[model samples]
Target chain A: MKFLAEINVMPQKEILDPQGKAVKIGLQNLGINQVSDARIGKHIQLQLEAGSEAEANQIVTDACKKLLANIIMEEFEFKLIQL
Target chain B: MKFLAEINVMPQKEILDPQGKAVKIGLQNLGINQVSDARIGKHIQLQLEAGSEAEANQIVTDACKKLLANIIMEEFEFKLIQL
Candidate 1:
């Protein structure tokens, strides 16, 4: 089975997102007002072949902990769709 | 219109990916070898009510340039889906 994983990695809540902040400031200059709290992060799609949904979930979980995300500074969640 | 934007923000080609490199080394330690060149990034899904695909595309492009992406360090691509 093929699975599509979407992952997001951002600074922790207590941590400041300087990149996001800078972009927010830039947006202000662009005349797009009413925008607040702009946070910047990453997204990834993984096409993986697995035996079953359970197996795919396990693989993704392991991948997140082992490779895909930095738990210290990032948080991740994924939706599995068999293709 | 609903648009699914898959974005990747990595160190420029000339820049090194220390985070990805560390993950690569860690994956080796997990005994699931044969993986090389592990690059990490971000994916975002946007549910927008647009008049048409063209308008949606324009919104996405502008969003990327103005907010969703950092042209200096990131690259982005998106797909449009009417929902």
Candidate 2:
């Protein structure tokens, strides 16, 4: 089976997202001032070959923990959908 | 009402994502070879003040169309959750 993992990797709440802040400021400058607390992170989409749903989830978990996300500064979560 | 908008900005499929390609190569170098078509994008989380869910959605849609995404090279989608 082929599983698609859509992952969201975000900066820890305690971590400062300079790029996010910059974008927020950019937005404010553009006169769209209603949005705040803008936080930026990464969205990763990957396809994997797995025998079962559990295996696909496990592979994604490992990929997130070991490669896709930087745990020291960022946190991650994902949704799996078969494609 | 306070609402949270979770947005994903991704490179258009026809566009080349060098950073994403680099990350995929990095993964293979780390011995994770089961993954393919690795793509990278931005995850944006923001809080907004809106009178209703529909209003909030409009605000987010405008944000995505105007500032958060580059339509020529990237595409964006979002979900709004009340908080």
Candidate 3:
């Protein structure tokens, strides 16, 4: 089976997201003052082969935990769709 | 009313994403051979105030077009939710 995974890795609440803060300021400068807060993260799309749905889930989870996300400062979640 | 926007900015299909390529290689080195392709992009979460849903959409769209995304090399989309 073939699968597609859409993964998101976001900084933990306690961590400071300087890039996001910069973006917020930039938006404000552009006169979009309605914005109050902003956070930036990574969005990853993966195409893979797997034998079963469970196997696919395991692969994506392992990928995120082992390499895609820095669990110490970030958290990750993913949605897998069979193709 | 306050709204939250989830935005994604992705490299155009013709663009080469070096970071994504590096990640794919890293995954391969880690013995995750199932993955065939990977692409990386940005995920932004914004908290803002707006008068209506349409107004919120306009704000998010303007933000993406003006600052959050580089329209020439990237494409962006966002979902707005009432808060």
Off by over 4 Å in 3: none
B1-83: candidate 1 lDDT, tens digit per residue: 34443444444556566776766677678854443455566544444556678876776678677777667886777776665
The residue pairs that clash in candidate 3, if any, are: none
Q: Pick the TM-score winner.
A: 3
The count of residue-pair clashes in candidate 1 stands at: 4
What are the lDDT figures for the candidates, one per model? 0.64, 0.89, 0.94
Model 3's DockQ? 0.92
Model 2 residue A78 CA deviation in Å: 0.8
By lDDT rank, best first, the candidates go 3, 2, 1
lDDT of 1 by residue, A1-83 (tens): 56665556655668777876776576568764433445667654555667788987887778877766689887777777776
Find the 10 residues in a row with the least total lDDT in model 2 chain A: A28-37
Q: What is the lDDT of residue A37 in candidate 1?
A: 44
Candidate 2 TM-score to native: 0.94
> After superposition, which runs of candidate 1 have C-alpha atoms over 4 Å from their true positions?
B1-29, B32-40, B43-61, B70-83
User: Sort by TM-score, best first: what order?
Assistant: 3, 2, 1
Q: Which 10 successive residues of model 1 chain A have the least lDDT summed?
A: A31-40
State the lDDT at A67 in candidate 3. 99
- Write down the lDDT that model 1 would get: 0.64
Q: Interface Cα RMSD for all candidates?
A: 4.7, 1.1, 0.6
The best candidate by lDDT is 3
